[model samples]
Structure formats: structure tokens, C-alpha cells
Target: MTAELLEFLEELSRALIASGNSVTDTERILWSVAESQGVEVEVSVLPTMIIIKAEGEVSRMGLAAQSPGMMPLHQVTEIYRLTDDVTSRRMEVGEALGELRGI
Candidate 1:
């Protein structure tokens, strides 16, 4: 699972850069985010990004634009955290997303 996650992160990082996006400090942030989710493995840092794979069961998280997309990690992270059985580390994704005013 860790291997798959790192691989995906590396690929996603490349894709993000190819499309022109700054990933500065993203590795740490992503690791935190992943832990916030239910990903129990360590997020290994690749050349450009961090990787952590989904384990056991994988859920198709969709996007919020209602464009027929899978739910994004940000949306399901808290649920994952809850699933991980940690009751005190919840992050209100909806609230945080609501604060993204101009983006």
C-alpha cells in the first residue's frame, strides 16, 4: 500500500508540475493530510512529493463541483480519520473549504 501511494504521489507531483503548480511544502502537508485521512502507512517523500497508499478498502471520493467526479481526498479525510478510530483528530473539511473565498 505504501508503495502504491508513493508511486501515485510521484506521478501526481509530476502531473501537477507539468500543469504548472507549486508544490512547495506540500509533502509535509500531504503527509499530515493523509494521516488525517485513514491512510495508516507513512508517506514517504519522493523526489518531488510524498506518497501514501490506501489500504484495506478503497472508497471513490468525489469532487464538489458536481461534475460527475469521484470525491476528493479532502472531502473524505475526516471520515477516514474517524474510521481509523481516532476520535479527537477531526478536521472540518467542509468548513475549511467554505473559507476558500476566491479560489
Candidate 2:
């Protein structure tokens, strides 16, 4: 996988965690998102971290910390849209990363 893809996966994990998803739920959701976009991804969710393997080439690991409470619906929806845009190629990795950071 390219560095951009790796970075994207890492950011995605962070977003999921920030959106109040448990580590296991984050892995499941991310895998489903990738598969829906026709991408193959392998995810391993540990007690405190998530590891994403993509394109059979690169693996990116990130810390997983759930927010104190539920995230607002709007923010969760926005994150889902951003993930879709990135995985579907509707947005560039850099652009998606920027948008995610802003969120």
C-alpha cells in the first residue's frame, strides 16, 4: 500500500474511536466500509490499538481511545461520508485527510 493509504487508514481508526466506537466495533465498521468500496482490508483490534493491513503491502497501527460519551449524530454522519468519499475515490487521500482532520 502507498503511504497515503496507510495514513488514511490510521486516520480512519482515530475517527472511529473518536466517534465513540469500541475497538471491536471500529474494526468491524472499517472492514465493512472497505469491502463496500471494493477494497480488501485486514483489521486487528487489540485492547488499546487497531492495526489495518491494506493492499497486501502495508500495515498501519494506531492507538484506539473511545470518546467519553456518544458522538453527535452529525459528526458521526460526517465521518461516515468522509470514509465513503475516500474509499470510493471521490476524494483524494490528502483531501480526505484534511477533511478528517478538520472534523
Candidate 3:
């Protein structure tokens, strides 16, 4: 479960960055999602990369292949909605991942 959550966070971080979120906003979202799930994660994000560390043998560093760019407004809205659902525990990690892929 830790690994799955970590993977989900890494992907979420990438998505947030790629969708033009600032590093600070991205970090806040990551922390909120992790904390809401009752997990402790160390997250660091730059314009080009993100690092996530957690217990239970989960660690990930994700590098962006390109610069951050704007996504469509609807896509950005979906991402925020997803984040909200996760933080509120209305969506499980697995289900969030599936929904994220669709975004």
C-alpha cells in the first residue's frame, strides 16, 4: 500500500507540475493528500523534478522531460477536483490513480 501510494503521489506530482502548478502549490497538494491518507511523506519539488520519500520501502524521484506548460482549464479543474477528493478521503488511492490516468 505504501508503494502504491508513493507511486500515486509521484504521478500526481508530475501531473501537477506538467499542468503549470507552482512548486509550492504542488508540494502543498502532495502533503495534503498524503496526510489525509494517514501517511507520512517527505516531498521536495523543483521546476524539473520531484522527490518523494516514505516508509515501507517507498522512494521515488520523478524528472520532467520538458518544461512546465499550461493545460486546458478543464483539465486543471479536474486535477484540483481529484486532489480535493483524495484529501477528503472520498477517493481511495487506487481509484484516484485510475481517475488520474483518465485525466
Best by TM-score: 3
Q: Kindly give the number of clashing pairs for every candidate.
A: 6, 0, 0
Candidate 1 residue lDDT tens string, 1-103? 3443333344433333333334554345445545664465444443433344456433322211222344455534433333233213443433333322212
User: Tens digit of lDDT per residue, candidate 2, span 1-103?
Assistant: 2566667777888888777767788788677656655668888876568788877766777786666777789988999998878667787767887888888
Report the candidate with higher TM-score, 2 versus 3: 3
Which has the greatest lDDT? Answer: 3
Q: How close is every model to the real structure, measured as TM-score?
A: 0.32, 0.72, 0.91
lDDT string for model 3 (1-103, tens) is: 7888888898899889888888999999999899998888899999888999986565799895554456788987988899899889888989998999898
lDDT ranking from best candidate downward: 3, 2, 1
Model 3 off-target regions past 4 Å?
Answer: 67-69
Among residues 3 or more apart in sequence or in different chains, the pairs in candidate 3 whose N, CA or C atoms overlap within 3 Å are: none
Name the runs in model 1 displaced over 4 angstroms: 25-29, 36-103
Supply candidate 3's per-residue lDDT for 2: 80
Please give the lDDT score at residue 84 for candidate 2. 76
